[model samples]
Target: MYKQFLIIIIILVTTHKSVKGQDNQHPKWNTWATWGDQNNGTYRNPVLPADYSDLDCIRVGDDYYAISSTFQYSPGIIILHSKDLVNWTIKSHAVADITQISPEMNWDRMNRYGNGIWAGAIRYHKGKFWIYFGTPDEGYFMTTAKNIEGPWEPLHKIMGEAGWDDCSPFWDDDGQGYFVGTNFKDGYKIHLFKLAADGKDIIKGTDKVIYQSKGSEANKLYKINGTYYHFFSEVKADGRTVMMERSKNIWGPYTEFKQLSHAQNDMNSPNQGGIVQTQRGDWYFLTHHGDGDWFGRIMSLIPVNWVDGWPILGKVGEDGVGTMVWEGKKPVSGTKIITPQTSDSFLGTRLNEQWEWNYQPRADKWSLRERKGWLRLYAFGSLERNDNLTKVGNILTQRSMSTKANEVIVKLDLSGMADGQKAGFTHFGHPAYSAIGVHCDGKIKRLEYNLKGQVTEGDQINQNVVWLRSVWGFDGVSQYSYSTDGKNFKDFGPAYKLMWESYRGDRLGIYSYNNKQEKGYVDVDFFNYTFAGPQKTKK
Candidate 1:
C-alpha cells in the first residue's frame, strides 16, 4: 500500500513540473503576447524559430515538416518536425558540411550574406523526398533522399535561370507532377512545366505560362472542391498583399485575383505559408512575418476556411494579416516545453544545433575537451571588421530574444591572452562590435570596445590579467566592466548604445575575437544568461 502511494506522488510531481515547463517554452502564440494588436488577434513576434526565415512548411497526416532559406549560412538545409504546426523542433539538417557544396565557399562570397538559397521547395513523393532550390545570381538545382535525414544525393542542376527565387512542385490528383516558379525580373510570371516520370528531369516540351503576378515570389497551389487556387503575393493598392486566383483546371485560366491580406509596414510580408488540415478536418494557414532582424523573420498562423469552393484566408472583418493561430481543435499531443537548445557548457562533443558560426568557421578556430570543461577560441583575423566579412574565430551565437531586457554573463579564464593578443565578449550587430582582454605594449590593458561602426569604450584600466563581464541590454544599450580579483569589479565607463552601421537586426551575443598576427586562444569556462523584465534589477 505504501509503495502504491509513493508511486502516485512521484507521478503527480513529475506531471506538475512538466506542465509548468510547457507554459514557458510554448507560450500562447494566439494571445497578444505572441502576435501584436495590429490585427484583431494576438501579435507577438518570433514565433516558430525566428532564426529560420523565408520558411516553407507542409503538413502530412499528423506530422508537420518545414525548411527555411539558409542564405550564406552553411548547414544549408535545416529540417524541422512538429505534430502541431505551432510547435516545431529541429530534427536534423539536410546539409551539414558547407564543403559538400563547394570547397572555395566559407560563408564568404558563395554563402555571401543576403545571398544563396532565397526560398526552396521540399516535397515528398513516390516514397522519396526532394528539395529544389536556386541561387538568385546562379541557377536552380534539385536533390533527393529516400529518408529526409538524408544521405541527400549530390545536388543536380535543374536550370540556370537568373531571375527566380522560390520554386515549388505540385503532384496533381490526376497522377502527374508539375513544377511552378516565380520569374520576378522578366515578367513576374508563374511558369509551369511537367516533370518526367522518373522525377529527375523536367520535360523539355511541357513549358507554359500559367499565371502572372504583379509582384510575387513564393508561390504554391491547392485544389479545393474542384477549384484550383493559386495563392501568391501581389503589390496591391495598399502595398504587397497576399492574393489568390482560382480556376476549374490545373492549368489556370485562373480567375481574377482578389486580395486576401495586405502588408502593413512589412509586419505582414506573409511571404510563404502552407495550408494544413488538422485531423479534426479544420484548415489553418502557417506563415511568416518580419521583425527587421537578421533572424527576426518569424512564423505566424491564421485560421483558413474554404468558402464557396475557394479558400478564404481568415475572416473578412478581421484585419487581413498573418494572425497568430495558437490553439487548435486539440492540445499538442506531446510535451509542450518546445524550445531550441541553448546554454552550452562547452563539455559536449559538438556545439548544440541552436548555435551557429558567424561565418564559415575554419578547422583551426577552436578546440574542445570534456576533461577541461571549456571551449578554447583561438585568435584569428585582423580587426578590419565587417559583420558579414570578418572571419573571427569561435563565434557560437543565437538570435536576440524579444524580451524587454536580457543579460548574458560569460565566465572565462583569459590568463592565456599574451601581449598583442585580445579576447573577450562581443555583441554582433553590424560592423561586429566587441570588448576584449588587452595585453598591449608590455602592459595589461583593456581597450575601448569598437568595431566596424559600433563604439563602446571602457576605462583604460591598466591591469594585465583580469576577468571580464560585458552586458548588452534591450534597446541597443550596452556596458562593460572587469574584476581583478574575479569578484570585486569597477564599472569601465559611460554606458554606450550599440549601433550596427550595416547590420540587419538587434542580434547580440558573446564572441571571442583576436586582432593579432600570432595565434592565441581564450578558454571560456561557461556562459550564464538570464532574461529580466523591465522591473527587474540589474547590478
Candidate 2:
C-alpha cells in the first residue's frame, strides 16, 4: 500500500520538526550553546564561551549592545544582544534590585559574594542608554536608558567614593561630559571626572589624576581622530596587559603610554575590554580572559589595529605587542546566528532571560503566576541549620558554559513540597556545592545529596514528579542525577570539584530551601540544557 503511505509520511514529517523545535517565540540556534557562530562563516575565540566578565561594546544603529559584570547577580547589568559582534542574546537586565545597592542584598545575607556590580561602561549618549558602574562596596553608579531593551534608570550614586574600580563614561566633541575611574584606594590611580551636562552631577572640581600604571584598571574612554584615547587593563608580570593612552587633552600631561597586549600565543591574559567599530570599518577588541579558568572571565574578540594613533590589540607583531585571535573573520556580514542564553521551558510569563537571582529575590518569594507553567520556588528558609550554599535565598542561577560537555535538566514539581522543604538541582559554586534533591521529611520524602558539606541520603522518592540532573565535565567535573520517570536517570552524589568562587563560574542552580520552616514550594517544571563532547566539534 505504497509502504503504508510512506510510513505515514515519515511520521508526519518527524512530528512537524518536533513541533517546530518547541518554539519559545523563536529560539533554535544553540550552536553548542556558547562560543560564536561557527556555521562555517568562520568564528571562534572566547567570543563568549561563557563568563561575560567586564566587557562593554556599543554600536547602536545596526545594533550591538553588550554590557557585563553582574557581580552579586540579582540582575545588575547584563544586557547582550548583537547583530554581528559574533552572535549574542540575553538582551536586558540593568538592575532589578540588588536591594537597590545593599540592604545587605536582602536583609543581611551580605552575600555580596565578590562585591557587587564591578567594572562598567556602555554608552549610546545623547539619546540615552548610558551605564557606568563601580562598587568597591557601593560608590560610583549611574544608569540611564532610552531603551537598549530596558526600563533602566534607578542606580545613580555618582561617586560616594570608596576604592573605585574600573568605570568609564564619556561624551565629548563639544557636548562635553566625562568620567573615568579606577582608584583602588589612591595608588592604582587613573581618575578623571567632569560630567554634568545632565549626565547627572559631578562637575565639582573635575577630580583629575589622569594616569598611573601597574595593574592599571579597565578604564576605556575614547575619541579617536582628534586623540584622547586612554584604554586600560594592566596586570603585567608577563600577563594581563593591554594598555594605551593618548591626549590632545581630555586632561593630562597627556602622555602616550601604549602597551597593547603581549599576552601572546596561548592567549591567556587578554585583559578587560571595549573597542568596537565594524559597520565594515573593522576594529574589534572586546576582551576578557585575565587568566580565569573554571570558566569565568571568558569572552574575547580581539583583532584591532590602528598604529599611528594607537589601538593595536591582537596580532600586530614585530614587537608592537598584540597576538591573540584563535580564529576570526566575520565582523559583520549578514550575521544572524546568535546563541547565548540556554534552554528553559518554564513556559513563559516572564523569567527566562537565562535566569539569575542568587541574591535579590524575595519579591513575594518567587513565582511565575503561581503554577500556570511552573517555576514557583518559594521556601525562604535558612536562618541557620548550618545554612550553606551561601545562606540560601532563592538560588536560581545560570551561566556555566565553556562547553566540552554539559547537561542541566530539571523538572521538579514535588507537589508543593513543605515539611522542612528542600527541592533541588544545583552545582553552584563558592566553597563548592552539589545538590540533587527532594527532602521533605514529615510525610517522608528523602533523596538528597548536598555533597560539599556532606549530607547524603537517597532512595525514598515516592514520586510527585522529579527530574534534577547536573552533568558538566571538561575537567571541571560535576555529577548528580535523579529522575522519577522522566526517563530513568539514576547516578547521584560525589564527583563535584567544579570550583571558582566569588567572581563566579560553575552555576546551574535552581534551588529551594527551608532549613526548617519557611513552609515549602518548588515547581520548576522544565530547564533542559545540553551540549556534547569535543567542544561540540570545534570550528
Candidate 3:
C-alpha cells in the first residue's frame, strides 16, 4: 500500500512539473504547424513561414537580423533576430508610430491601407543600425538606432517626392554613401543617388537612372571584389524575376547581367530580399516568393553560388539562372529552435512582440493594465468614420502563419461591452477580411460575421464570456466558429476567401469598436493558436 501511494505521488509530481514547465514558457498555439527549424541541423525554405513581406537580412558578427514591411500596421517595419538563420525571434517593431511619416497613416485617417512603409533595407553601418524604406505615396524615410532591439529614432523623410518604392542604402569602401531604389513613377526606373554624410537625406543633383523596366524594383546595391553589383526584380514575360547588373563604378553605364533567380519557384516568384554571407564565408540569398496569394510574401533562404563574381541564388539550371531550393543545412547551428511567439495569455503589461496594431492606434483605446491579466480594447467608432472593420482602430493582430492548416481560438470577456460595441476574434486579410464578432446592442448580445462589410447575424449570445475561433486551410479559406462555454464551438459564418491585400497576408486579430457610441469595452482573455507543421527534411 505504501509503494502504491508513493507511485501515485510520483505520477502527480511528474504531471505537475510538466504543467509548470508549460506555464513558464510562452504559450504555443500549434502542436506542429510553425516550421523552418527542423531540429536536425537542417531547415526548410522560408526560415519564417509567414507574411514577413519584402524582407531584408543582414549579419552583424554572429547575429542575423531581418526587417519586413509592416505596411499600415503601427509600430511599423517588423524587426526580428536569429542566432541561426533558420529560427527567429521578434525583436521589436522599428517604427513606434508611423504617423510621423504621414498623417494618412494615422488611425483617424485610415487612408494608407497598403501604402505605408514598402520594401526597405536594414544595414548596420559604422556601428549604428540604419533602416531606409519608401512608400509609394510618401517618398522615402529612414530610421536609426545603436541597438537592434531599439528605441529607434523617429523616421526622417529622406525624400519628399512620391511614387518611388523598394529602397536600399550602401556605404562604399571610401566612406561615401549611396542609395538605390525604383522610381516607379518614372516607369520603374532603378535610380542611384548619393547620400548625405549623415545618411538622413538624399543628396540632390546626384540622382541618375541606371536601369528601367516594367516592375523593376526591390533594389539592393553591393560592392564585392571591387565591383558594384545591383540586384533588383523585374516582371518578365514569364513573371517577376530577380536580375542583376554590375559596374566598376557606383555610377554606370553598367553591364546588364544575368538573371539570379527564375520565375518558377516554390515561393512563386522568388524575388525581393537581401543577401548575407555566413561567418564561414558561405553565401545565401534570403528572398521572398513575391507571387504569394493570401499568405502574402512568404520568405525563402536560397543558397547563393558565386560564379565568375556573379552571385546566383538557388539551384542553377541548364538555362543558367537559379531555381528554388526548399531545404538546406543550417547556416549557423547549435542554437535553440526559435519561432516568433504567437499564443498570447495577455499576462504581460505590454502586448506580445508578435502582435501589431492595424495602424497608428489610439493610445487611449486599448489597455493591458485596465484588467489585471487581459487585453482590454475600449469601444470606439471607426477612425475612418465608417462601419468597415478594416477602418476600425486598436485591433491587435499577428501574421497568420502559412501552413496546410492553422487555427486560432480567442476567449473574450464581454461583460464590459457597452451597447453597440462590436467585439471579438477575426481572421482578416487584404481584400477578403472577415471576422466572427459579438455585437452588444441594448440587452441583446448577438453573434455576427463580417465578410468585407457584409454582416450576417447568428444565434444570440447570452454569455458575458465567449470563445471565438477561425480555421484556415492550405487554400487560404477561413471558417469561423464560436463557443459560449469555451468548449463546444459552432460554425458561425460562411467559409470566406482570403486574399493578399495591400501586400500583406491574413492576420489573426482581436478587436472592439462601436459605431454608435464609445461606452463599452471588451477584455481578451487569451489567444490560443495552432498549425500543421512542416516535417523536418533529412539532410
Candidate 4:
C-alpha cells in the first residue's frame, strides 16, 4: 500500500510540473506558424519564416537575444528574445527613428528605399547591452543600454564616412575594443579598426585591410580559445555560402578561408549571420537564407561543429563543407513557447512591437489616445510628390512570414472619415503596392481595391464599419477581400503578386491617405492574422 501511494504521488507531481510549464510557454504559434518546434525535442527549418534578414544573435546567461536588419523602416533594428533558440518573440527595437541618419531617409523624400539600417550585431558587455550597425549611404552607428529591455542611448555615429556596411564589434581579453565591417566602395573589402572605450567612436588611423575578395562581406569577429575567428559570407560558384577564417593575431596572418556551407538546389544560399553559444557550451548559427523572394530572406538556425579549431555550419559533408539541415534537436528545452507578436486588438494605448512605420512618421498624424480603444489615423497627402500609395507616410506594417498560407483581416471604422480620405488594409515593398480601402468624397464612400494604379471599386459602402482582408501563401499570390458584416468575405481586386523590393520582403501595411486634401481620418479597431502550419491556410 505504501509503494502504491508513492507511485501515485510521483505521477501527480510530474503532471503538475508539466501543466505549470506549459502555462508559461503557452501559445507558441503551433496554430499560426508554418515551421518551428515539433514539441518532441526537435524543431524544423526556417525557424523564423519571415523577412528578418541579416540577423545577429548573442546569448546572455540562459537567455538568447537577436537583432535583425530593418532597411527603410523606422524604429530600425528589430530585437528578438528566446529562452531556447527555436522559440522566439519580438522583444523591442534599437532605434526610434533612423531618418535622423540623413534627410534622404525622411518619408517625404522616399529616397532611402534600398538604404537604411543594414546588417548589425548585438552584444552584452561589461553589464550593458550594445548594438552596432551601419548604412551604405550613412556610416556606422551604435547604441547601448544597461538592460536588454532598454532605455538605450540615442544613436552615436561611429564612422561618419559612407559606403560601409555589415559591421559588428568585438572586445579583446585585455578589454580593448575593435570593429569590423565591409567597405563596399572599396571592392567590398573587410576593414578592421580600433573602437573607443565607450564604443561610440572609431579611433582614427587604426584602420587596416583585414581581408578582401570578389564578394566578401557580412563581417563578424570573434575570439575563441586564444584564436581569433573571422566569420563572413562570400560569393562562390554555388552562390553565397557561409565562410570563415582564423588567426592567432587580431590583425592576422589568417588561414585560407574554408567554406562553411554549400548552396542548396532551390535557393541562392544560406549565408550572413551571427554565431551564438548556448548555456550547455554548444554553439549554433542564426542565419538568413541569402536568397530574396516575396517573403525576403527568412531565417534558419544552423548547428555549429568545432572540428580542428574551425567551426563548420550546418551538416558536414565529405568535401569538408556543410549542408543545410531541415530539422534538428533544439539547443535548449523545457522552455515554454513564445511566438513573435502579430495580430493586435487596438485595446491598449501603445502599439505592439511588431508594428513599424515606412519611415519616420509624422508624430501628430497617428493616435491611439484620440479614441479610447482604436488606432486613429489622419489622412494626409502622399509624402512623395506623386500619388503612389507606397509613398503614403506612416503606413504601419509588420514582417510577412514565409509560410504556405496566411490571412490578415482588419476591422476599420470609417465613421470619422472626411472628404477625400481613403484608408484600409494595404501592402507595399520596393516593387509594387496595393490597397483595399474605403474612399470618402463628397458624402459618398466606395469600397475599392487599387493595385499599381489599377482600380477595382466595389458597391457603395453605406455601413460605417467594414472588414478588409488579404490572403496569400507560399506561391506569393495575394487576393484582397472585404465584408460589411465581418463574415462571408467577398474577394475583390485582381490577383496580386507579393514582391521583394528595396532589400525588403512584402510587409502587411495599414495606410491612410488623401490625394485631394489632408482633411479626414480612419479608426482601426482590431487586426487579426492567422498563418497555417503544413496544413493549408484558406480565407
Candidate 5:
C-alpha cells in the first residue's frame, strides 16, 4: 500500500508540472506568423517579417507610425501604427486613387508593376500629418491629413522634374521648412531645397547639391541637438550601407560623415529606414534588408546607441561598427502583442483594412451592397489575350506573411458567374503566377488551374458554393486545393515555387476577368487564414 501511494503521488506531481510548464511558455501574438514582438517582453529582429520596404517611422506622444513603399498597390503608402515599436498594426493608407497620377493605370493597359510611388517620407508638423513620395516616371508628390488614420488630401504634384526619388521633408524650430531628395538623373547626388511655410511649393532658386555618392537615396533629414543630420543609404563595395552626414547649418559645407551599419549576421543590406526614440529614451532604427527573396525586403528594428553625438545601430563591436540583433530587450515595456492585419470576412460594409487592389479599381465594377455579407467583384474585361493577371483590374490582394507554412481559404459563390468569365483565387507575382478557380463555359462550370499562362482543367462543379485553398511552405513551395462541402479538400495541381518579381513578393489575390465582355461576377463570402510552424523563441 505504501509503494502504491508513492507511485500515485509521483504521477500526480509529474502531470501537474507538465501542465504548469505548458502554461509558462510565452504567449505569441501569432503562432505561424514569422516576425513580431514575443509576448515575454522581448522582440526578434525583422520585427515585422514581411515586405514593408523603404520604411520611415515617427513617434507621436506614446504612439508610433511607420509608412512603407507600395509600388503600384492602391491605396498607396501603407501606414502602420504601434503602441510599442515591436508590435504593429495597419492603420490606414495615404493614396486612394492611382488614376490621380496617370490615366494609363485605368485606361491605357499600362501596368506599373514596380514603378509607382517609390520610397517617400512621413512627417508630423504643426497640426497635420504629411507624406511625400515620388514615382520613377512622374515627378514628386505630397499629401496631408489632420489624422493619421485619415481621409488624406489628394496627391499634390510638387515637382514635375523627372528622376527624383526617396525624398524627405523637415521643418526647423525657427519655422523654416526644407526638402531633401536624391537625383538619379543628375550624377546620383543628394539635393536640398528650401520650402515655403505651407510645404506645398519650393522657394525658387534655393536648390543646392548637398552630397554625391553612388546609388545614394532614401533621404531623411533631422535637426537633433542643435545639429543638422542627413541620413541616407548608399551602395558600398561590400553591400548597401546606411550613411549619415551632419552639419551645423541645414544646407552647407557639411563636415561629419560616417557609415553606421552594414550587412551583419544574417541581416543582408540592412539599410534605408528612419530612426525613432521610445518614451523611455531608447532609440531604434527601423530598416529593411535589401536581400530580398520570395518575400521582398523584410523589416527589422535595430537598437541604437548614441556615441559621440551619433546614433550607432545594432550592436557595437571592437571595430565600433554595429551588427544586427536577432533578439533584444523590448524598446518599450508592454505585454501587448499586436500584428499587421490579415484575413477578412466580407460581412462588413467596407473592405477590410488588409485588402489593396493592384491598381485603382473601376468604381462601378465592384460592390458590397449587391449581396449582404459578400464582396461582389464584377468581371471586368481583360486587356490582353491569354488572361494575364497584370492586365486585369480589381485584383484584390494582401501581403503574404513570412512563415514556414500558411494556408488561406476562401469561400466563393459562383451563381453569378457568366460565360467566358474566370473568377477565383490566385498566388500572383510577375514572371510566375498560379491560379485555381471556376471557369464558366456556356452552362458548364469547371475548376481550372492556370500556371504561368498554361491552363489545366479539372473536375466540373455543379454547386454554386465552392471553397478554394492555397498553402505555402517555408521552402516557398505552394499547393492548391478545393472543396465543395468545406470539410473535404482535395489537392488539385502540382506544387508551385513562389518567386520574387518586379520588386514585389508573392501575394495572395482574389481576381475575376472576362474574355468576352464585362458581364460575369463572383461573390466572396470570407477569407480565412491559419498558420502552423515552429514557435519563435530567444536564440
Candidate 6:
C-alpha cells in the first residue's frame, strides 16, 4: 500500500515543520485580543534582560561577570557577560562619563534622584579587571582594567565617608589582597583593607576590625579549599528579612551568626549577595529581589552547600529564589532575542536597550532615528509629575516587559500640539507617577489618571485630532480609554487601582512622558506590547 501512503506524507511534513518554527519564534504572539486575551503566551523571567538591581557576581575561567545597582540610572557600571549561567549580554557601560560620577548636592536628603552609583564589586585580579564601588554620598571608589572594556580609569576615591556603602574586594592565594567594607558605621565593623599592586590604593594595612553587625549590610569574603569565609546580611523586623553570616579567619575572631534568608512575602528584600565557584567545584549565590515598585529589580540564584564547613542555603527550595543554571549551551555567546523589545514599527536603529533616561541621556530629547521608523518625542518642561520633572528634566523610562499578564498598545498621530503642548503615556516610580496625555491646553485636552503622590483624573477626551490609548495593570490595576477614529475606544472611567509605592515581586511596563516646555513634539505612530498566560487562548 505504498507503505501506507509514505507514512501519511511523513506525518504531514513533520507537523508542518513544527508549526513553522513557532511562527518564526513568536512574531508579536497574539492568540486573541480585546482584553483577557491568551493563546500562545510566554515570558516569566526566562532571564531576558531582567531589570538588574544591586547584584554583583563573579566566576573566572569558564567566564561569568556581572554588575548592578545604578541608582541614578545613566549608563553607570553595567557590564554583564555569561557562559551557561542562563544567557546574559550587555557588553559595556562601566561609567560612560557624566563626569565619571561624583557631583551631587542633595543626596544627603538620603537620596535625591542622583543617588550616584550603589553596590557593585567584580574582581579578576592578576590578569587585571576590578571594580569596587561606593558613592553613597561620594567617596570610596576603584576602577581597573586589562580589559572589561575600556581605558577605564577616572574614579579612585577609595574612602571619603558618608557611609561608604557596599564595597567588596579581595585577592588571596597567599600573596594577599583584601577589602570588604560595606556601610561602615558603628566603629567600622567589617573593614579589612590591604591592596596595592597597581590594582589601586589602600595598601599599608591598619584597618582591620572584622565582623560587627547589629543587623547587617552587604559583605563578602571567601577562600574555600582551606577554610576561610565570612558573608553578611540582615535587615529584618518585618522590613523583609535577610539575615546571614559566616566566618573562619583572615582577621576575624569570628563565629557563626546565622538566619540565612527570610521574606516569603512582605515583598521580598533579598539584598546584596555574591559568590562564585564552578569549574566543577560548584557553589553559587548571586542575588537581588524586589521586582516591583513600578517594576525594577529581579535576579536570583542560590545553591550554597558546604555542610560541615558551614553554608547550606535554599538548596533550591522554599522559593529561596533560584534561576540561572546554564552549563548547557553556555549562556553568553553572541546572545540575541532582543527581549519583548516593545514592538515599535516606527522602525529601528536605536533606543532599544530597553530605553531608559532619568539622569543623563539627552539627544535633543528623543527620536529613534528621525523619520525612518518614526518615534520622535520632543517636549520638556511641564511634565512635572515630579521627581524633578521640571528641574532635573522630564523622564522617559523602561524595564517591565512582562511577568505574565500583559498589554501595552501605543499608537499616536497627534496632528501636532501647539500651545504648552503635552503628549502621553507614563508610569514611573518612587512616590508613584502615572500618565496618559494628549493636550494643547488651549483647545484640546486629556489627562487620563494615576500620577502617584498627586495628580488625579483618570480619564478625559476632546479632539482636535484623535487616536490615543493607555492601559497599565498588575496589583493596583488600571485601564483608560480613548479614540476618535482608531477603532472604537471610549471608556475612561472606574477601572483604576493604583496605590503606587510598589516593589514586591514585580513586573510591569510601557511609558511615554511629554510636557512641552519649549519645542514640543510627539509622533510615535506605533508601539504595541503583549504577554499573557494561563494555558494561552487569545492571540
Expressed as tens digits, the lDDT of each residue in 22-71 for candidate 3 is 53332122222335877788876666668888889999999999999989
Candidate 3 Cα RMSD (Å): 10.6
lDDT (Cα, tens digit) per residue for candidate 5, span 63-143: 899999888888889999988888888999999887787765553455677788799899999989999998878888999
Q: Is candidate 1 or candidate 4 better by TM-score?
A: 4
Candidate 1: regions farther than 4 A off: 1-49, 99-104, 107-111, 146-148, 196-205, 223-227, 291-295, 318-335, 369-372, 382-394, 429-448, 453-504, 513-515, 532-539
Model 5 RMSD in Å is 6.7
> What's the CA RMSD for each of the models?
9.7, 18.7, 10.6, 7.8, 6.7, 18.5
Candidate 6, residues 345-460: lDDT per residue as tens digits?
75676655444455564456677787677777766553343423223343555554334455566666565555656666654555445555565556556654544434455344
Of the two candidates 2 and 4, the one with more favorable lDDT, higher being better, is: 4
For residue 466, what is the lDDT in candidate 1? Answer: 56
Candidate 4 lDDT over 150-186, as tens digits, reads: 7788899988889999998999999999999999898
Query: What TM-score, computed on C-alpha atoms, does each candidate reach?
Result: 0.77, 0.39, 0.91, 0.92, 0.92, 0.34
Worst lDDT run of 10 residues, candidate 6, spans 29-38
**lDDT score at residue 439, model 2, on the 0-100 scale:** 84
Candidate 3 structure, TM-score to reference:
0.91
- The true-structure Cα RMSD of candidate 4 reads 7.8
Candidate lDDT scores, in order, read: 0.60, 0.77, 0.84, 0.83, 0.83, 0.56
**Higher-lDDT candidate among 1 and 4?**
4
Clashes of 5: 1
